[model samples]
Target: MSAVPLEAVVIGASAGAMEALSALLPALPQNFRLPVFVVVHLPPDRKSLFAEIFQAKCRVPVREAEDKEPIRAGTVYFAPPNYHLLIETGRSIALSSDEPVLYSRPAIDVLFESAADAYGPALAGIILSGANEDGARGLKAVAAAGGVTMIQRPDEAQAPDMPLAALAACPQAHILPVAGIAAFLQAL
Candidate 1:
């Protein structure tokens, strides 16, 4: 665990995102103190229903990230389909239509990297189940910025490539199962 008090959390996922997120997000208590930013690779052709779905299960507020929105504590913001979600230096949300990274428009790297810049050591970055290596570099950036970095144990993930890649890039990251990750967030 990080000694620095965390101010925000950034989570990235792909292939098995829905299942992994289901196990994680609903665990946060309604009064959880930090803002949570999530980027799950979604088809660029459709609108994201993540906010609607998670809002029904989570105690905290859940909504799609909107451009230029202020970051608020106890809220879960999911990137809209086709847009890269970024955290501004001013602690606000910024959505971008930048070209896809790793074939995904709402790239995990963009979110994690920008968040690391914005929150520095006050951030916690988590990599979950996914089939690609999109988040590896971003998790490394988080670590470089003195943020806490975590990855779901590869053996327990439905899609292990992402976690495995992140582990390789950031050997120091905490490796935990989904339930353990949830417990860590709840205790924050």
Candidate 2:
């Protein structure tokens, strides 16, 4: 049985993400509470140090995703810089030079949409500070799948375009500040 109340968490960040992730990560207990998947836009062909950096600060194990890996609790899964990370029973990390949807390869929408299909009501999708409007439709899919959804308050975002786009897509989404977001996850 999972120690965390929720079955899964899917978080997406881009612009101003490092700071936002720093704030949110430590808020969870060292043992953490659930399976957390994150997609942060990064340039292809670059060696992303994000997983290493985050693993240091977090109590839970963290790694760049590998295709066909089974989901486990208390672990953080990050999309590789170039691949679109997706959950389909097995967490799939697929690399493609294909055109960027909404201009991102490790696109937030792709992750959330696949996760919605895989985990459905067990998922919680979070949209954080970002430059592009990548996560909105994915977050919408999460809601349609009976999952919980949250968007950072556009006003509080470093680049409000992402969260604002999410709001425009799913007006019923819970808009929250940075501090309240972790607590909201805890409540779930």
Candidate 3:
């Protein structure tokens, strides 16, 4: 099968996210050319060092996503602790204090749904290890938009609820272990 050219990638993770992200981020080649957007559940009342931690370990630049910021290829943008991250029609980012989805403020569904709408067939969405079912509908949205969808193999996930839920919601999503995910993305 032919591979679709991707403009961007979006990832969602929660419980056990740190270890999973550490394994996945370093696998991206230094020159890999796509903007990566990520949302990981964090307490709304606390500050998060998610970007800083990943930036220190990842080959690509990683930073907190800012409103109206133009997404550049090869950079990683993390949704801040208390806001919902959305994509604007102009290809910029917008953060909202909208009510949480699935009990998380920086909901994966919020980011994935908006991104799928903005990027359509050129987007790729990934649902990683998490304790909740938050990313299920969002992965379905990505697939419905003709974007590629990937789910961490349930057996390989530290907390499989998120991946299993995604597969149930979008059965066609490619199921891969963390290592396979890294390789598949590098191949893209």
Candidate 4:
């Protein structure tokens, strides 16, 4: 069992996210109690079908996060295409149109940092395959806040830059392959 009593799990990815998530999300046990938030880079002008696609595959509830929506355990929330998703002090979702970070509107850094503040030591942040360095600092913030941090092993990632950047920024982050990450979450 995990020592942290994780209240939330935050995941960030870019280029190769869909496949990685396909391997990860469907594996969570149906009774898993922690809320999960995900940020995956995508074109802002397009509509997102992430919720529908993942919901069809996952045993747990999956939906696109809405502004002011209450954060609920046992559900997985995905940031919409253009909005930067945040967790407010009241534990409600906040969507922003603020200037994009790292050339991405739904930046992973935004979600991970906000969650690190909201959940503190009870949060777990995971950085996966991507071509950019967007999530590195946010993962560091999670670790600094005493939350658990993880990175998909670089060599195993479909695009290793994001994981490598995260590993460089937060050397202590647990390094796991995608399947290993799923197992770890199940164990938690």
By TM-score, the best candidate is: 1
Question: Candidates' TM-scores?
Answer: 0.99, 0.91, 0.97, 0.97
lDDT of 3 by residue, 58-96 (tens): 899999998889888899999999999998767999999
Evaluated against the true structure, the overall lDDT of model 3 is 0.91
Question: Could you give candidate 1's per-residue lDDT for residues 49-99 as a string of tens digits?
Answer: 899999999999999989999998899999999999999999999999999
Ranking by lDDT: 1, 4, 3, 2
- Clashing residue pairs in candidate 4 (N, C-alpha, C atoms within 3 angstroms): none
User: Best candidate, lDDT-wise?
Assistant: 1
Model 1 has an lDDT value of 0.95
Off by over 4 Å in 2: 1-5, 90-98
Better of 3 and 4 by TM-score: 4
Model 2 residue pairs with clashes: none
| Candidate 4 regions with alpha-carbon error over 4 angstroms | 1-3
Each prediction's whole-model lDDT (CA): 0.95, 0.83, 0.91, 0.93
183: Cα error in model 2, Å: 1.5
